[model samples]
Target: MVRCVVQSQWLIYSKHLPSISTAKRHSIQAFPLFAISGRGSSSHTLSADDNAKPLLMGPLDNVMPRHHITPKALFIPASSSSKEKILKILKSGLAQTIKAIPTVAGHVKAASNPIQEGSMCVTTPFGAVEDIFTAQDLTESHPEMDYDDLKRRHFPMEAVDSNVVYSLPDLMKAEKPVFLAQANFIRGGLVLGISLHHSFGDGTSLKTILQTWATCCRGESAAPTLTESTRRERLMSSETGASLDEFPEYATIPDNIAGYQPGVAKGEGPEIAPEPPQVDSHVFYLSAQRLKGLKDLASAKLEGSDWISTSDALSALLWRSITVARNLEPGDAATEDTRVLNIPLDGRRIMREDTNSYMGNMILFNNATTPLRNLLSSPPQLPEIARTIRQSISRIDEKYIKRAISAIGSVPDVSKVIMSGGTFGESALTISSWGNLHMDWGHVIGGPSERVRVSKIPFPGVCVILPASEPGNRSTEPNGVEVMIGLKSDDMARLMNDPFFASFAEWRCS
Candidate 1:
């Protein structure tokens, strides 16, 4: 039976934890009336008093993103409004919609309860936005650089505005790159940048938030309602009093990843993205049926289990594709050392399905690969990649999520994670899918209602985000998952049309 815990808001707050440690730290351990098993079945009783410890942390603490790549360019075309009008709209919208810009940790440090400015968008007492823009970047030219190179680096929750301070309430928020100009009135070229935080939601969520602001600008009503649009929940349960015990006060992070290096030198960073013909967005399709077909084909050739998540399945496909494109032996990507495949896991599952709309970011978990030797030494096949990925994913239990929830505090400095993932490198590639583009921004903006649109900014060599135009209702579009992958000019040129990636018909038709 499909077992899901239903929680009350009080339990959520009461269960909020500051840290997660794998070492059983709690001095309490009492088995409840029901037994607990690894699988979700009624036969395996997960009673209220059992020692479940924590398979997952609070909602926000578990969904923090590992590969947060800023796109080389984020083009926001103010097609209808004057530049000045757009700038005013942006500032006012930002102020009204959020208390502050998001950061890697999902925290938005605000002043006292009654904001001194009385505006949701906070400004530093000295007249700067919260961690808005840095002192160095405020100068003219703001250091001309390449967009692709810096795409992988994490930005402080501060704004590109330069007047903000710092701190996280608990989680981060993923915000889209905003366009602001010196002369809000002038029709000169646009300048692009984003407030560093926003790992809490998917790219589509950010786009919807921006479109929500656009609607606010027009004094129009937003569709789906904010309460309905943004849902949230904490994964840990104190239900029936909870069978799992409290977390160990000081649990250590799993260092099981053989060559897992936390921080790496920024060899190159992404600068600016190219201006597009128009701000074109559409829902791409990746069907469940197609996925099933592929899985069947792979299963015939390779003996692997059918119980696998869609993400693990697709990632295996992409990994196989990349290795093929590179023509490296599966072992080749591995040095005499281990090779890592950085996978980003969403945190929506951690939250209660009934909850909605949050101001900060959530915790993100990654299923990193084992050493190169292991991957290379094993049987070679695309499905095998899937199997390995499945194995890796299996290790990302609630304990690891708990550790990640506490990772923000571990930021040695700069309020960033120490992990050095290849988000901006040409070799790094990411794939993501939003189950279904269930909401529509056009409807909110008072336009003809239609499918929604979203993006995953390109950084991790090749970035992909999938959002279904319809949830399980396949008639709208089966396997209609929007995949948005960004590649530097050459990389895109090489792999854009390869068999591994095909633009969704929804995207093409739109």
Candidate 2:
């Protein structure tokens, strides 16, 4: 099934631009140029040949608005000497990367058959570049804030101005640029902002492209392994199994034959109450200590069940905490049943396919539900809540993923019809984890002198969980997981006031 995944990144930080006592003065220059799509791959370059043409949107991409964009960012501290060279590499290699991942170089267009398949086509894709600002200007622009505060200010919580960078000309505005980038020189550091349409791909796809770009920037000759061989046709062909009725709508089931029932169905469920009009974004982190306590709490109640992951426990905790913040009553069965945790699981490594090099959206949601009363019980049943999430995730095995892929492929407008459920209703939460995405790997610029120290990204209305380095495992410690959430003003106020919720994270509100 075609999945239209949107992603973006906006990072604000200066490499080696700390206190004068710690940072040396460095000169900065800018190279802002749009990188056109290339046509071949070789040492120091990537080119598209077969899949280079305008590609049709997949079932996944059909769900969201064709014009919608997702923004994200990265912070890299580099030396003054290597900064120019780095930008040169990026400018030169951008074409190569696009050639390898043609979708990123393409833009959306009106599809001939909108009803049978998706309505947009990603055509003539290209990358746009812009110099945002220098480190001194970035610091001067917001002098009231501290270093950390400045980083938060530059985080891309929403869509950026595509026109300022790699936007298509009015005459050629057939579709959104599959990708747009902006480079901000932070004294001796650099911040890169990239925005992608939701229909293009998911986090995995974006990361894959970036990693490949990094490889090319470092002068690697290896071309990205595009596994579009026979799989492309399988995901696009009309199939009966992709029917919304046959598959569990709003939520997914472990097996098609099991017939497990969820609380809601596609286009047949009650609408969730409207969300509060005003909303704000906040970022919080779960330290190793608090995370350990949470895992222990969840495990305490497992009673010899299969192991639960840190992700499961945290999701349950957040679900429980949000329910409490909403002041949900402990005894309302109807209110309780609607509360759900929409956790998306990646299907790349699993299914035993060497699809690690594969791009586009490859994800399935595990919608776990529990009543408010059970979650907010006298002592709070953390384990049971965690178990529910674990079970839901467990159901996403080879059989389930294969079925989901087929199911997504079956529907022409899969996003609109299948899983048409709303998160606004019933206090539902959707969480995306970047802990395993390896975003920090090869995220260096110029030389190895300075690396990407931190990244600030939040899913405006949803939740994003990122990982830090593990304990004793210093290698991954820098990549520790942090949760970024955007909530209504009222919800944010309550969430911050709740000591229990506040204790687990440092609430950095924006």
Candidate 3:
């Protein structure tokens, strides 16, 4: 067993087990993690010949955000072992996993094609293990908090700050790491935070990485073997170039918009509000029974032949509740205003190919719009609203996906294009469903995680649906669903107090 002593807001590991040197500890706290490299063996270095070549960027990859992805925090329950032992296991597993997916250990560089000037390419370098992972001793700082309390509350904002759970290079730097992970040793458990560059991959890709890492940590053989071609493939248009006239998703907007930057390429950075609004995040849980009732209510007015999925019903409920919470006055102006719901549609299914092992962004938005009056009526037209969302998403077929790919490829400078449907704010909501992700890490951590949270929501009017704690761990009905939503402070307050909303979703935290 390993012993730990707390002194001066730092953890001092016993001599029997390897301990981080004083210099190394201070360096971890003072400097950016990515800046500390080359401490590992020379074998970690990439060959000059291999390093000279760059991987091609997919059409979807070219239009993704270039900055760091919103970090994901996993709240593991307390275990019997010491924090040092857990950290060692996590780090070792991560090192092994990176060996299989080397692209994630690489850096994002500028694409060579002049026409695709704003796009990105990736290249691996030496000492990737040392540069991408770090551990911080937080037991001394948060001595009073325990696993149960932390699991029930919202993740502390300070824990998500730079150099704490993760770090990033200067925006203007020529290259940046595609993946980063940090382990925070708290009082009773650990918070393992992981971040991936938007250009590197999507949520599905991240899911694969997490599962493989868990398998490695469990000392299991037969962890999936992924090669460069198997993990990633360059996405191109069948028609060398296509026009955007048929694709309404990509548009050019004025610089005065909320996310618009003067010289920065469109879709390259997080959406920033000139004067940041007061937004609050809350997690709401809907039990299986409540979800079924909601679906029945939504389908009451639909024709027998018409069908609406459980996701469609849940999204419809959220959209109507949020709209009502806005408390728009009853008038022509309020009725004329529109509420847009944007749902991200994964392309793997539409392509009719087995891309379960494929990694990278393959997503498009399903824009569903409805007038405020319809959503805010005395008796809301829920069935119609749900049908609208369902139909919008159903429109995305293989042909449509290919056309979108071709249209995005036609852009000379991808940074100049923006989503034309609408922006995310008061009048719009963007919801992404991650309920299908396999989040069980108990095999390695000794117990299932009580909660999983995204470090932050990039903008207001955004929400993420997280998976249940156990896979198929249900009784009588499916397990409950957890939704993390970010909205203006006042709107969130009204939403929490709304009786109709409370009838279904139980508010867990701010």
Best by lDDT: 3
For model 1, residues 210-316, the per-residue Cα lDDT tens digits are 55544555555544334223222222232233211222112222333333234532111121223322222122356667666556544554444445566666666
Q: Which ten residues in a row have the lowest lDDT in candidate 2?
A: 10-19
Question: Which digits, one per residue and each the tens of the lDDT, describe model 3 over residues 155-241?
Answer: 443344445655555566667778777777777777777777767677777777777677777775324435432233334335433
Error of 3 at 454 (Å): 3.1
Candidate number of the best TM-score: 3
List pairs with backbone clashes in candidate 3: 266-415, 281-510
Q: Which ten residues in a row have the lowest lDDT in candidate 1?
A: 4-13
Error of 1 at 38 (Å): 24
- Per-residue lDDT over 1-510 for candidate 2, one digit per residue giving the tens place of the 0 to 100 score: 111112222111111111121121111111111111112211122344445455655554544344433455455554444556666777656656655665666655556544433345665434343321111124344334232434544333332223322322233244456666666554445556555555566667766667666677667743535424112332332222333343332322122212222432321222222223455666676777788878888887456548898888898778877777666455655552556666666666564545555455555656676776777776778888888888877877766665555555454333233242232342546666762433332343543211122232222235667665222356654434567776666777787887777767665434
Work out the TM-score per prediction: 0.46, 0.72, 0.82
Give the Cα lDDT of each candidate: 0.33, 0.50, 0.63
RMSD of each: 14.1, 13.7, 13.3
Clashes per model (N, Cα, C within 3 A):
84, 47, 2
